[model samples]
Target: MEITNLETLPGKQIIAHFGLVSGSTVRAKHFGKDFLAGLKNIVGGELKSYTDLLNEARDEAINRMLNQAKSKGANAVINVRFSTSSVAQGASEIYCYGTAVKVS
Candidate 1:
């Protein structure tokens, strides 16, 4: 499905609105990754391990949201947004949401 942060998709007209759709995932830092991250922090560089984890989590959340929109007969999702929050001491939640719509 076409997903965009804009309220409207270029060259496409919204035919119907299916309210809101959302998906979320909670992920915890792996011990091995945490150890690597700590070492990277000491050197003050990018933490590849943690960065990969977040990227995967974000993709999963977006996929789930797209599935929900598809199930609702939506061809696209507009005004897509993402959020992140600490769910626990070591766990974080990634959420994606948007307005499901049919466009043509």
Candidate 2:
């Protein structure tokens, strides 16, 4: 399915709109990675482990959002957006949302 962050899909007509759809996932930091991250913090550098974890979580959330859109008979999703929140001391929730639409 096609997806875009703009208000509308460029060069495509939105024939039908399916209102709002969302997907979310909660992820916790791995113990080993957390330990490594603590060490990295002491040295002052990028925490690649945390970065990789977040990226993977985001992708999973997006895939779930796309699946929702597809289930709704939508060929695309518009004005896509992502948000994150700390759900627990060691975990965070990744959220993805968009307007599902049929486009041509």
Off by over 4 Å in 2: none
lDDT of 2 by residue, 1-104 (tens): 99899999999998999999888999988799899888998899788988888998999999999999999999999999999999998798999999999998
Collision pairs in model 1: none
What TM-score should be assigned to candidate 2?
0.96
Candidate 1 residue runs with Cα over 4 Å from true position:
none
Listed per model in order, the count of residue pairs whose N, CA or C atoms clash below 3 Å is: 0, 0
lDDT of every model, 2 decimals = 0.92, 0.92
Q: Which tens-of-lDDT digit does each residue in 1-104 have in candidate 1?
A: 99999999989999999999999999888798888887888889787777888899999999999999999999999999999999897688999999999998
